[model samples]
Target: MLDYKVRTYEEAIEVIKEIGFLPLTQLVPNYPSLDSITSKEHWHTGSELDPWLWRAIFPGDGVAAYGKFVKKKSVLISSELLPLTRSTLGSPRSVNERYQDGLMSREAVELYTLISENEGIDTRVLRVQAGMKDKDMKKPFDNGLLELQGFMDIVVSGTKAKTNEAGEKNGWSSTSFETMDYWAEKNKIGKATIKVDKAKMKLKDHFTSFCSPETMKAIYKIFKF
Candidate 1:
């Protein structure tokens, strides 16, 4: 088994590069779950590692974190492998087609449009601009955001600490997001050099080394390919 004990941001980047993709934490709820096998003690929350610090380093760090559907939160992906991962899901074209076909929900379209127009946005501000500030709209807004992220159309760019009514820092932060294409352009990330089918096979073979057959099936299901 590969060592998952990452104690520093640099170490975390190395791990993500080796694995190609990894959930930020060990508590992912779906198959190929990190919860059972990954040691919690090495997590950002549990250890000296902090996710915010990692995000701060991501601008040119060659690693990125975004929703991957294996968990409720984002997954860390190495820049070298991001294009291949995108290929597995048939991105860009697929996301655009879904939007054109009206397969995307109204909320998702609104969120996408706003992000597209603005380039990038903080979550709190985005919620207000997208008409999702109401408590009742929370679930739909969150789901819509996740939908875009899962489709590889959007990704978390960074974060800023939240402030209270008095404008004091609450020590909690809201994540900021940007379209994947925007991120790629800014980071100089390129498209996959390998064919999509080859990318899928490569990822599958890598996963099989560490995951069970059942988990492998789940990975395929999660990627929808």
Candidate 2:
């Protein structure tokens, strides 16, 4: 017996691809069909679903995954997709169940997490963004995460300041760079190619390139993986 937690089926698929087993992972080891998870009550059969990608899909399913899997004193919780569950069954049973049945790679899940966190895009909306029609497009890719991860260094480091009614610095920054201008001025960063406020900012050809390493670090830190 075993238990697992995954937010959605797509996430499960993402994890599998991250680990370089997109096709096999999606097949549901032992060949469980899409309907199998939709119908079966127990997903963690203790035979399959033993990958880190599967562990992250629902890393918090302590009760549902752990309770059933950990029958004896020595229970190995690795090779899991999501977090360990202890009490709750899961969120949105119908939706997540379908997702849980699906398999993905941990790297894929992490990349997805980074993109959504960075863009502030909601996970639900991502389903549409990915347009995960076939297993191929839906399968994880290293390029997406690698490019994004590199940007993380600059996205995290940050500085902050505050202002008063007169529009003067009432005090030192109490928060990360008060605004994009503050980021530009302090870091000596040039205008970016894709600034939300100025269409002209795009003139830089590559907005991210213009950003200083510190600025990029700040951006990365905002979104935790």
Candidate 3:
């Protein structure tokens, strides 16, 4: 459990770094979350203390990597732990190799290519660019995005507000996606090829300090670590 209720975004960042992993909401029983530790009153208030704001701003800043990582839910992982986490959860094969091997759908590969070619591409423009703007293509577009995020191939780097033709903000902000390799490179994270077995073992060992046996079980089951 958190030592105290988190009241600020800075504290939240420290918690993420200390825990190494945190979902936006509690997906596993007794698992820590920004939601569980923060006050609801402060949420969605467009303030510096808001946890919702932190999700978009904290990533790609040399502190954490954010994406739909755990159970394909929004999650934050410390930059220090990202390499191990990626090695454990992400496929060793390249996107092209996975597609050629029949492990990835064509739509997913296309989306990945678009994101790879243009870093920090938001889903709004991505859909139109990839010709997935039609309602019928929604599922495929969503699935492809989720697939890339689940494998740590892409991460939420930031957000962009929707602007009207008059140059005024309109709707809620659109999230910006970045290729993980590009993020790591820009962050100066060294490339490491850790064996999955070793990576999993290390991750579990790190979690033992804060996670209960049942929580660990749930983590392993959900993340398939």
TM-scores of all models? 0.78, 0.17, 0.96
Tens-digit per-residue lDDT, 1-225, candidate 1 = 343554566766666667666665453233322332344554456244654456445634446645544445667677877887887764546555787888777788789889888775888999999888999999999988878877778877776778889999887677777888888878889965577788888778776677666566766775555
Candidate 3 C-alpha error for residue 57, in Å: 0.9
CA lDDT for candidate 3: 0.86
Query: lDDT values of the candidates?
Result: 0.68, 0.29, 0.86
Give the CA lDDT, 0 to 100, for residue 223 in model 3. Answer: 49
In TM-score terms, candidate 1 sits at: 0.78
Model 1 off-target regions past 4 Å? 27-48, 51-60, 69-73, 94-96, 164-168, 192-195, 208-217
Tens-place lDDT digits, model 2, residues 65-105 = 11112111111121121111111111222222333665334
* Top candidate, metric lDDT: 3
Model 1, residue 221: distance off in Å is 3.5
Q: What number of backbone clashes does candidate 2 have, counting pairs of residues 3 or more apart or in separate chains?
A: 55
Candidate 2 structure lDDT:
0.29
| Model 3, position 164: C-alpha lDDT score | 97
